[model samples]
Target chain A: MTLSSGTVAPGAPTRTATGSVTVRALRLLESFTAERPELSLSELARRSGTPLSTVHRLVGDLMEWGALERDPSTGRIRVGLRLWEVASLAPRALSLREAAIPVLEDVAAVTHENVQLGVREGDEVVFVERIRGRRSVRLLTRVGGRFALPPTGIGLALLAHAPADVQERVCAGPLRRFTPYTVTDPVRLRAMLAEVRRSGVAVSDRQVTDDAVSVAAPVFDRSRAIRAAVSVVVEADTGRPAQLTPLVRAAALSIGRALG
Target chain B: MTLSSGTVAPGAPTRTATGSVTVRALRLLESFTAERPELSLSELARRSGTPLSTVHRLVGDLMEWGALERDPSTGRIRVGLRLWEVASLAPRALSLREAAIPVLEDVAAVTHENVQLGVREGDEVVFVERIRGRRSVRLLTRVGGRFALPPTGIGLALLAHAPADVQERVCAGPLRRFTPYTVTDPVRLRAMLAEVRRSGVAVSDRQVTDDAVSVAAPVFDRSRAIRAAVSVVVEADTGRPAQLTPLVRAAALSIGRALG
Candidate 1:
């Protein structure tokens, strides 16, 4: 997928740190996604667009901090446990996931579907946790994995509740598509966001992947701010989004109470 | 909370560009334990024993990777979400936690106790996860917290299964005490470790805290190697240790199965 260079705002870290070699060293990390969890030093330098010397220094610092660890056999650097331990405590991710787990558990038990918890982080939604039954529909998302906040049900639910500026900024640019059903039109996406707020839940039918449909509802914090969103993803053709909506919404509400 | 000044024998990264400054920066990160999640820049430099310039440069690399995040309101450095995201995937922490969750959930549900999971990391047992029932007893250990593998039940369970060299080294000296009942004698501690292995369980009664008792059992990987342990901490005076043993051991066995 091609990212629109024009759509990348000036304030974005990707833009702000374009010239900093230290920042370039750090971007080497972004190359090690869940699907690609390890890389060689030269591979990192190549992917992050940095010199080998810069990559070496940066990797040393990162490995020292336990941000990156080397596979003993392959000597490839991968994201370290120390990094994950620290990130797991991010109040947005950990606490939200903790408060939502019991609720997510109940939802999973009831529907025997994939239950996901997510919160908005910038233009994306980071999946905080997911509980999948054996028969849960296949999906690409994993805990701590991030996805654009417009195409996912949880994303739509969160986006509908996001600040006006963030919504406008996101809608001002490129939209991504997975399947033919994925929403790509800015005006229509905005309309759907408004409808999500009015309806108290978000529904995406075969948007993320061809075989999955998701129903999600916003979770509120003690201050009545939208804190997170819970979604149930099921096999699209066999799933009844309407039938699953109330269960997902109730789980989100229960989690909201726990968060408060 | 003092660590001996030595190299991380297996995985420490040596910085050719910088000397002790590399390890010093790492020490700064090590300072952010479960008890201390955030620190000012001065605190970082002080704890690291590095010049402010070095600290500043190191912090830049760290912040770039999201291993260290600045608290937006306070402008202090805290363990970042990027770090936590990576650590949450640690096989020792995440996989162990995932494997133990169901069994821990069962124990927490049945006994309404504080269920814990931990694994050996270096000479210490790092708590990976915990499920606190509504009526759980008071406790000190926390998820992501570390303690010497000689006091807590889970720690003792792990220590029991460790190799001879590790056991001899641990029992040689530096047995810190948490309370009056803490076993400071290496000989006595060694005996306890042996008993834990023989009996396939451990009970830490008022070892760390005066009012709590933890019953623990070891969890094994597919190769029948000890990978971690699970425990349930309850009010010291409210339960029989004998009754809790079978339950904790069964839960640990269930977790081992999950791991396999």
Candidate 2:
């Protein structure tokens, strides 16, 4: 989540409002990102655009509740383990991850390729878990990171099953171009989604990066509604998407059954 | 985390204080547990001791900020994926898990035993990650769960290197017994800690359950401060703690080096 100054607008006269205090506290947390996991008090105040005094009070409340922690050696602030424990109860991420890990591990063992699980969030795909293959090509994705829905195998599988509005919003593009192989045209992207639904698999050959290709399949819940997508990524030149299709599809099925 | 009405005590007249709003928001989140991951609005209000009106407003703000989500099918509130994404940046958990996963995977592949990573929190050990062994004994632990720091091997390893005050406080009694083989006596527990320090490995033979035993070793950061613990658990009847000691220790060292 990106930190925004609009969370506590300067011109708003209700700075001390109880509701705004809660919003300010949450925004202070938003200030800590993967890039800057640790921040000093002044840095947090400046980044969050809150007054120093307000930041100090909010940080104290957060620390007392264990939402934030002070680093022992550097004395900088960081996201706390207590918060992670509570957030682990998130069913969309945790339940899906629990059901998919065994299947993903099996695929990773056999292929020695990157295995990933993702779900569509709005017009993007949010990765829930990833198992790095020992000798696989380097990946730009990380757990909890987001990527555009048109450039990844997992994204395509999810977009294929997404609602009409979501699909249209994504296909009505400013589709990002990661590599020359990335399909950016709105018409072609829609065609690919249709192909994904028909074939029950999606292939992104060197779309996200020039060195890697991924094969993905959709996972369904008990109601037969698409719940998640699973994929395996490997070196572009050596990997065969056709050969990987059945394995990926089977893994998705097993995960869905486990979820049920 | 346990939810308590004490958060917004009825006896305390400062219920409308700005600070209390932040506290109330957090306590509402604490109401969510692994067993009851989703709850209705009235359940949340009743559990948190906040009035339904207050819960309605707080839930609105929280949902708007993506700290909470409503299930599409059930209409019950659950922890949001966005919160999990933000909490994923908690350095104590995330950085440690990233460093140890490769080593833990190797150990799991070789032994087909449960491999776990944990860190000390106050007087408890909070599990950060676990890789289940297909053929291993069923464990009572889960990721993000907390347990007392005396009965399990990972807890023992962490307790051995904990500060003097923490060690004294724990050894001062009330060590809850999990099984007949659990070491609850303060004298015996102290002796076990000393042995863990001397040998650089801890063995808990059926301390947590009648069917399992584990061997754990402490992982240290660059400053030589104990940062976490890694362990392998297997069936007690056929598992050999002595045979697993070196493998667990080496994995710990490799993880520590990776952290550096």
Candidate 3:
């Protein structure tokens, strides 16, 4: 449940050069997390490590541009709707999500299980879209959330197609364990990746949790390069993971065709 | 469809000092739009108003940081998934959308019509979330899309709760017309706003399109201040808009309590 990329925590500001005003302002935005969605001026300065006066000036500029807004009653700042409007144009996430939604919906409709679409980022996988099944097993993956690339079925599928260096780095070890079935041994994980490549399907059997298992397949772009992965999670004892493999794979292929 | 704030388009670069490398680099991201979601390096330079060499350097930085990505097949640059992941932390959009999704789903289930949640931004309203009902009328609104404040039911609900200055500014307008039923007169629009406040619901009878009508109600925060609005859009001739008013109002109230 607490998976994160090794490089930066979810909302921590990056240590970019202080001379750049734009980075400083963006860092202020990064300082706001799901937990602390609102912050006062002093809290912003403290979290972003900027001078109070500089925070004031930069916040003022961002406010004027509608990148941030201050609540009239509380005087606390939150990310503005305008920022979300612009960010929605991000092709890799929004465009891909838009293309995959219908297929994911179909998968959910047929399987009645949690359906997920994810893409690899560095050594981790970021879920771009997730559909909750009405009677499916509970899932920890939230849309726009990140997870390691060795436990979840979508993660394993993405990691299987990732560059050799990324795979090697991940295989070097320290994999976090979510449940007793979660893979932690690097050798076994590497073997699992090899099997994923060989079979064109990745089945994670209760790897992330005790009560659920997932089956995933890679999605390829026109150039035949893997761009994303799709997965469906069902209650561990109810459905056979191998039997669900074809359904998930077909949905992934359908989404890839739609993307093209 | 091209509704934009006069201050700046969603992805247009602000005309700040261009000397700073960070600002120039961020400008490259701003050059992308819904109409042009992908661009080449030279096109980015031309659109962002930066020199070719400067564009090369800035694009490299952005690509390295995963703020921009190059398509392997076409070499077109696109906003990366990383940027969207970061921006997903935006509270005004994400938090509000998260809080309202359950109620929106309920409303969609009961009404079998498009359920929308929107927040006021400047003189316009930006849709934070939208749920398309199984048998709903087609809507022009999309999540993260913006529209004028005088025509749509959600817009009227948000605008009615806005400050007096905002109401005055919108009332002093040349309102665009989508259909003959769209209210273009300032006097009638003013009265409609008054009625919305009095009834706690705003009904738009074929204001946005001839085939659809929407009923909306304002969502309030724990502080008793309006935070957003929810609406249900149905086929204009198929359903009675007045009967839908209570359903929308109840959903908005449920979402308000959920937010608290």
The number of the candidate with the highest lDDT is 2
Candidate 1, residue B68: lDDT: 76
Candidate 1 lDDT tens digits, A1-260: 11123322334332234633344545566767555677888898888777776576667666766667775546677776665555555656666676788788778768888899988877888888887754688887888678899989999999999989989988875998899999899999999999999999999888889999999999987677887899999898898889988888888889999886
After superposing the true interface residues, what Cα RMSD does each candidate give? 8.1, 6.3, 8.6
TM-score of chain B of each: 0.88, 0.92, 0.88
CA error at residue B9 for candidate 2, angstroms: 21
Residue pairs in candidate 2 whose N, alpha carbon or C atoms collide under 3 angstroms:
none
Stretch of 10 with least lDDT, candidate 2 chain B: B1-10
Native contacts conserved, per model: 0.26, 0.52, 0.39
Q: What TM-score, to 2 decimals, does candidate 3 have?
A: 0.87
What's the candidate order when arranged by decreasing lDDT?
Answer: 2, 3, 1
Higher-DockQ candidate among 2 and 3? 2
Docking class of 3: acceptable
Span of 10 residues, lowest total lDDT, candidate 3 chain B: B1-10
Model 3, span A121-157: residue lDDT tens: 8788898888777778988777777888899999899
Q: Report, for every candidate in turn, its global Cα lDDT versus the true structure.
A: 0.76, 0.87, 0.81
For residue A77, give model 1's deviation from the true position in Å: 5.1
Q: Tens digit of lDDT per residue, candidate 3, span B1-260?
A: 11123423333333345423454565567798878989987898889878876676566556655567777567788887766777787777778888898788778768777899999888999998887778979788888788999999999999999999999999899999999999999999999999999999999899999999889999998888899999998898887888887788888889999887
